[model samples]
Structures are given as C-alpha cells and as structure tokens.
Target: MRNILVTGGAGFIGSNLVRELQVRHPEARIVVVDDFRSGDFRNLRGFRGDFVTADVSRLDWNAQFRDEIFDAIFHEASITDTTVHDPYLQAHDNIEGFRRLLRFAEPHQTPVVYASSAATYGICSGVQEESQPAAPANIYAFSKVQLDNLARDHARRFPAWRIVGLRYFNVYGPAESHKKAAASMIYQLYLQMKAGRRPRVFRAGEHCRDFVYVKDVVAMTLQALNAPRSDIFNCGSGQAVSFNEVIAILNRHLGTRLEPEYIDNPYAFYQPHTQADMSRARAELGFTPRFTPATGIPDYLGSLSPS
Candidate 1:
C-alpha cells in the first residue's frame, strides 16, 4: 500500500495498526482521520503523518480528498460504546459513517479492512463462527451487524473490491486507557489492584471470553490486507479464559494475593462466554494468535512500568 487512509486512527487498535504500518511501510504516505470522540490524541504520540479532524459520518469526502487517492482505507471509526441506547446516534455514526467510507472507496476501488465485533454473536453455546446468524443484544452490536450486512451487499455489487471484516473479541493492551469505561477489564482490574483494592468480578468469575492481546489483533489486521476476496473472520486467540484465571494471572504478575470480590451483574444483555473459531481466519488470512493469557498479561503489565 502506498497512499493509505486510517479512519479512527487515534483509537486503540487503529493507533497500534498505524504505528505498525509506519514501521513496515515507511515509503507510504499515511493520513489519519478521527473526530476524537472516543479516540485520544496521546495514542498518536510519535506518529508522523497527516491527520484530519472531522466526523467520518458526515464528512464530505469529495471535498476533502479532492484529487487525492488512497490505496487502502482502514475503516475503524464507529460508536463502540455498547451501553449507548440512542439508536439514532449509533446508526448515524457507525452505520452511516461506514457507508460514507465505502462510498469513498468505490471510485478508487480501494481495499477496506474494517473492525467488526464479537458482540455480533450473542449467547452462543459454542465457539462463535462467521457462518452462524448474528444475534446482537445491544445497539452497539446491532450497528456492527448492520455494517457487516452492508459490506456483504457492497462486495456482491462490486465483485472485484477487496473487503475484509474482522469480528474482534475482548481486545486489551496498551493505549486503551482512553477507552474509559469502554476499556477492557484487564485495565480496570489492574487499576483496582494498584489501588490496593480487590479486583471485582461478577458472580463466581466463571464467565469466559477470548481476550486477544492487542499485538495479535494488529497482526491479524495487517494480514487481512492480503485476503483475496471479501469475507468476515473472527479475530481472537481461540482459547477461552475465565475471569478467575485472569485475576489469578494478574496476582502472579503483581506478586499479590488479592482475592476478587464477586458481585451481581446488572446488565441483562451480558454474554457469559465467547470463544472465536479461528479455523476460517487461519485457513484464509493465515492468522494464528501468538499470545495466551499467561504470556500476554505479564507483557502488558511490564509495559506499564517505566523504562
């Protein structure tokens, strides 16, 4: 890729991807576009590229781009807050924003690698796969499902366009502190432990999720660029780890014996388990997660300390 545009480049995954792209493709001209709603400027530290401050949902791409052409568009901009109940706002930003990006890519025939969500699969008994029907439980999840369907149609009409949608599970790692409440439990738990308070867990901490590290996610995203055709794939470690195990790992890393405080879950739409079936990603995108909870947690903790 030569000239590239990364929407939401200030966000967690997007910023990480942008950094890697800079290192791997030093000759490419990269531009980052973000409204800075949930994205933090600190995440873009040491970034050397153009940046556009505007909402992708309503930006006039024709006016903005003028004669510039992008080789690829990384569409990561979205309303990712799962607790937001306003349908109009969610649809406007996530669904409509994606449509705008897709339209911008149509004329250039640029490839798109966008972020999808594991929330698309609600209450799945087994590992979540792309073939299964989406059962989104919240507006955020619903927004992703709409985007996935739209991508499918876009691919059907534009047969040669390369579009890859990645359904990411619980992604946690560096540069996610800006996510605030939307940040992963790993950060939240770390904060609790740092304060000398016990890490809180809902129920018996038996709830399981395939929490993939950010580095692995960035690798899978870059690999998706090579996908020959349009398709959606799961981005996760393929191994299910319980909340209790996470706490245990944190305790080991911090050298503490802090016990977790179990509490009741208030949200009715909670998913007790989520495991990604990596068969499709491996066979198609050549994705294989290198970090398990044991390996990833310590690395994340280490990064938090000073050099």
Candidate 2:
C-alpha cells in the first residue's frame, strides 16, 4: 500500500486532496495531521483514514512514525490567516513546522511534496516563476518563502530524495465552508449573494491572480512526488483573471443580477498582481491547471451550500 502522510489535511485544499486520494487509492493508508488551527476538523467529517490530531511542529515522528516510512509527505501546514498580529508566533508554527518536518524526512529519506506560495513572488512585474527571487511582503508570505528556500537547499544536498516546492497561486474551490475570515473569496461571495447580502468589492478589483483549482493543484503535487528530480514549479492556471471577473462569474451562477458594491479598501496588505509562468511545471511535471473561475465557481460554490 502507498503510505501517504498529509499535513494540514483538515484545511481547505488539504481536506479536498485527502478525500480525492482516499477514493482513488483505496489500498493507500492516509495519515492526516492538522492541529485544528487554521483548518476546521469538520472538513474531515466523513473521512475514513488514520487521523492523528497533532501540531505539525510538536509531532513525535520518531515514536509515532517508527514502524513505517512515509512514501510522501504533503507539507501544507502553515500560518496563512492574514488577521494575525504576532509575527513571532506565525514564524514559529509556519516556518518551524516545516523545519521539524524536514529533519524528520531527511533521516527517513522520504519524498516530501510541500505547499509553497505565490506570495513568494511579491511585488514583481514580470510573470512569477520558480527562477524569480522570492521577496515576501507580509510575515505570512515571508514564512512561506523561508520554507521554499529551505526546500531548495535541502533538495540540493539530498539529490536522491524527491523534495518538491510547489509555488501555488490563488487556489480556490470546494470543501471550504468556513466563515468570511476562514474561506476564500469565491466561497464567501457565494454566501453573501445567496443570503441577499451584497458582497463588497475593494479597489475597483483590478488586481489579478492565477486562480488555480484545488483538484488540479493536488494532481500536480502528486505528480511532483513521483518525479525523478527535485524541483520547484509554479502550480497555477496559466490565465490571469481579475477579482471582478470572479464575482461576475458567481453572479451568473446564482442567477442574480447583483453587481458588486465598491467599498474603500480596508486591508492594505495585498499583492497587486500574482500571475504565474507555468512553463517550468509543464515541462518538468507535465502540470497544467484545468479550471477557470468562470467554469469552476458554479459547481464549487454549489457544493458548499448549507445542507
């Protein structure tokens, strides 16, 4: 059986990936570890697998994971919430979590496929690629960038192991049922419009992102683990779309003519543009994102309804 260890499996994309892998690979024994922090536990309500609720940093891997060696590690645990005030705490959990996981993986020589961020390419003008030097704007972005750098150097030393750092763009899709503060824009916007409450738009919504679907990201990540060489790849939809276009697509799905209400931008922290150059991912991992907001929002939103 293919033994897969998924960190942060209770979160949005992680939870979805857990479900997908379980269904596809029945013989696989999936171990999910999330501290019940950013990711909701309810996300794994019907999940059938080995559920170990432990902080990724505090995990006793040597004892708990002694009998078995992991085939792959989905390193998704990190500090992503923007409302955080203490930068020190964020670094400890987000940055240090991977540091510990790395130490664990290195000894076992397990292939670790981790979630890197597009935020690593902050304030850049050209298409964001793996070659671009990471310049993080916020503390959260900084932690993710730090993790990517660690992976880069780690892979260089351990050429025999598969260490993939996937720089994920604006990822959004199903299984995100948390509040406004927890879920993505698409999910929150759907809830707003459905409840007859107008969703507010900020800064004329000109900023663009390579909004990749969760399913596509998972597929590419799995492919990365099986790859022969260790590398970092931009896992994102090749097409860039504005935030306004995202809301427009959601409106069509709800069958409502509700237009977005422009509001004064409150959160000053944001990346103006985060488009990706998926050329490397395509060439290396044969990764290509299959979902656009227009085509995907409807179904993804529909799946997250209050049942």
Candidate 3:
C-alpha cells in the first residue's frame, strides 16, 4: 500500500493503528481525517503524515483531496459514548459519516475497514457471534448496527468492492485518556486505584466484559486489510472476565490491596456480560489475541509508568 486514509486517526484505536502503519509500511504516505470531537492531538505526537480536520459526515471528499487515490481506508471515526441517549445525533454522526465515507471510496473501490462494536449484541448471554441478530440497547450501539447494514447493502450493490467491519469488544490501552468518562472500565478502575481510592464498580462486581488490549485490536484491524473476502469479524480477547476479576488484576499490577466499592449501575441498558466467539476470525483472518486482563493489565500499567 502506497497511500492510506485513517479517519479518527487521533482517537485511541486510530492513533495506535496509525503508529503501527508507519512502522510496517515506512514508505507509505498516510492521511488522517478527524474532527477532534472525541479525538486528541496528543495521541498523534511525533506522527509524520498529512492531516485534514473535518467531520466525516459533512466532509466534501472531492474538494478535500481532489485526485488523491488511496490504497486502503480505515474508518474509525464515530460517536463512541454508549451513554449518549440522543438518537438523532448518534444515527446521523455515526451512520451518516460512514455512508458518506463509502460513497467517497466507491469510485476507487478502495478496500475499507471500519470499526463496529460488540455493544450491538446488547444483553445477549454467552459468546457473541457475527451471525447473531443485532440487539443494540443504546443509540451508540444502534448506530453501529446501522453501519453494518449499510456495509452489507453496499457490498451487495458492488460485489467487487472490499469492505470489512470489525465488532470490537471492550478495548483498553494508551491514548484513551482523552475519552475520560467514555474510556474503558479498566482504565477508569486503574485511575481510581492510583489515586489511593477504592475502585468503584456496579454492585456485586460480577458483570463481565471481554476486555481486549488495544494492541490486539490494532493487530486484528491490520490483518483485516488483507482479508480474502469482505466480512465482519469479532475482535476481542475471547475470554469473559468479571468486574471483580478486573479489580483483582489491577490490584496485583498496582501492588495495591484496595478493594472495589460497589455502586448501583445507573444505566438501565447496561450489558451484563460479553464474550467473543473468535472461531470465525481465527479461521478467516488468522487472528490470535495475545492479551487478556491478566497479562494486558500489567503491560498497560507498565506503559503508563515513568521510564
């Protein structure tokens, strides 16, 4: 790939993917597009690439880059806050942004890989598979479901085009500090413990999530660019760890005996559990997640520590 486009390149997963692309394809010219709504420039420190500050939903692609041809396009820009209750804003920004991006890429048939979310599985129990019907509990998740629907429709219309969507589970790592409240639970818990306070979690601390490290998510994303066919795949650690287990992992890494302070889960649509069924990803994309909470937490904490 000689030239690539990464939307939301200043965000957590996008920033990590941008860095990896630079290392893997040193000669390629990367162009990043972000509106900075949920993205932080700090994440792109020392990044050597072209950047366009604009909202993907309202971007005039032809006017922005008249004749630039892209080898691949990574669509990561979206309203990621799950607590957002505004249906119109979520649908317009997340879904419309993707629709416009597809229209821009269709001419070149640029292979596009976009971010989807496991939240689309809603309150489903057990492992989440790609084939399962979407049951989005919030506007944010519903937007992602719409994205998948749009991708499917586009694929059917243009069978020769390549478009892959990845349903990410709970991802946590560096560059996500900017997300603040929307950041992963792992990061939030780490911060609480670091401040010499007991980590707070939903009561009983038994709600489980499949916390996959950002590095693994990026790896899976890069692999998706080389998929033989366009399809959605689950990107996660493939293991379900409870909130109490996460607190234990943090305590072990931080060397703190701080116990979790249980609190009521205020959100009425919270997911109780999520685990990814990665058999499809393994067979199709050769994806093998390298980090679970036990290992990922330590590595992430080490990265945050002073050198």
Name the regions of candidate 2 deviating beyond 4 angstroms.
267-269, 305-307
Point out where model 1 deviates above 4 Å. none
Better of 1 and 2 by TM-score: 1
Judging by lDDT against the true structure, name the best candidate.
Answer: 3
Per-candidate clash tally: 0, 0, 0
Better-scoring candidate (lDDT), 1 or 2: 1
Screening candidate 2 with a backbone cut-off below 3 angstroms (N, C-alpha, C), the clashing residue pairs are none
Higher TM-score: candidate 2 or 3? Answer: 3
Q: Estimate the overall C-alpha local distance difference test score of candidate 3.
A: 0.93
Query: How does candidate 2 score on lDDT?
Result: 0.80
Tens-digit lDDT string for candidate 1 (165-275): 999999999999999999999889988997889999999999998999999999999899899799999999899999999999999989889999999999775677889
TM-score of each: 0.98, 0.94, 0.98
Q: Write the per-residue lDDT of candidate 3 for residues 68-184, one digit (tens) a residue.
A: 899999999998877678899889989989999998899989999999999888888888999999998778989999999999999899888989999999999988999999999
Sorted on lDDT, best first, the list reads 3, 1, 2
